[model samples]
Target: MNTRAGEAEAVDLQVQGRVAWRHAIRSLLAQPRGSIRMYSPDYADWGLGAPDVIAGLDAWAIGRSQTSVRMLGQRFEGLQRDDPRFVQWRIRFAHVIACHALPEECGGLQECLLLPEIGLLVIPSEKSRLAIYCSGARLHAAVHAFDQSWEHSTPMFPAHTLGL
Candidate 1:
């Protein structure tokens, strides 16, 4: 994507595949006080498939205050049973991490991070991937879209279990 507001103009690089995914996750973790909203088929799959990324996200939760991580996707019942990494995470950081149901029509996001200062969208093809980071004026629009999606989402965990 073009950096219309000169936000990411200095960096014209686009990392692909696993490298790009790692970079995107790391960037999301670096944000001190922002929410992370992602959509996927099975959000819990990340915990099983990417150990390092899951660890980094847990670290982010322990260090950051007043932040939220919302995962919008199909219901992941396995998170409580089969996903040990996320089971541990929910035990300790359940307050900051929430899973939401994505509408059938929306399907899921390729990958997205709508932070306060930046926005990231990950596009993938059969052969490769493209990750885009947006800043400046465009970032505002991304955040707005995330807010709108978040409003219609319902919690994946039961109301009794959500600490916050």
Candidate 2:
């Protein structure tokens, strides 16, 4: 990955295996300075909760008040149970990070991460443990699609749960 004045150059790469996917995610997380949008059925096999990914998010959002991380998922029960570290991180950055539940109507949404400014888009296939990295027109289209889904999503995964 090459950076021109802190902006990553558009990249096109095919990533295979869990390790490569994780690396691609980390690289994507490292490049964005404005906002990051993600859509996944459930972050079950994705390493969004891994130390490095969480750390990258931490680094990206620490002092950047303008930066935002928005995530959309069909359900979060699995994520809540499987990725405690990510839940904790989300709690800490609740102000900057938002998690939403994808509306039932949008059940067929694909798993992707969009970094608009840098034109980076990541489409991951959990079953095959493969991912595609692309930019240019596809990235814009993905951003539009993600925005549509996000607009219909409901806020979820609150920072705190109130129990009586």
Candidate 3:
């Protein structure tokens, strides 16, 4: 998934599993004024790392409010079924944290993380997970692309908790 052409440091993270993915996401997002964009089928594991990710955002928000995380996901079944952690995080950080449902036509919009500050992107590699450690200009383009898709997505987040 290191689609970037020149000098892209991409690391496959499939073997690294959820914990590693969680820690890397948590650590990179530690500093403030950074943006995170994630696209996953159901965001199953991202919820597992909610504490650290939210903590990072909390630290990042120490003096500012504009900083936040935007997620573009597909299925809401798993997220809505029994994941209370994700529910809680979504509620607590409702203002700075938001989730949107991207249409199926937006193919390849699944299982990726875009961290602007460190030029990082975590993507799937067919048989593995990928971590594009540093791809400065490339990440910006991806971020822009993700934002465009975000604009078209519907809000299925707290709405997941609607009838409860």
Query: How many pairs of residues collide in each model?
Result: 0, 0, 3
How would you encode candidate 1's per-residue C-alpha lDDT over 1-164 as one tens digit per residue?
45556345423346577665655656565433467766655543244324665666676688655538776666667655666665666557767777777676754445566666666666666787666776665566656666677677776754245365
What TM-score does candidate 3 reach?
0.70
Q: How displaced is residue 84 in candidate 1, in Å?
A: 2.4
User: Which prediction has more favorable lDDT, 1 or 3?
Assistant: 3
Local accuracy by lDDT, each model:
0.61, 0.75, 0.64
Q: In candidate 3, what are the lDDT values of residues 15-111, reduced to their tens digit?
A: 2556666666566655535666777778666554356655766666555465377878888778766566556656666667678899898765435
lDDT of 2 by residue, 1-164 (tens): 55477553556667777677667777777546678888877777667787887877888878866428888888898999998988999888888988899977776556787775544344544576766675655677778888888889998988888899
lDDT score at residue 72, model 1, on the 0-100 scale: 68
Arrange candidates, best lDDT first.
2, 3, 1
Candidate 3 CA-lDDT value: 0.64
Candidate 2: list runs displaced more than 4 Å.
1-10, 117-127
Give the winner by TM-score: 1 or 3: 3
Candidate 3's clash total is 3
Best by TM-score: 2
| C-alpha root-mean-square deviation, each candidate | 4.7, 4.2, 4.7
- Model 1 vs. true fold: TM: 0.67
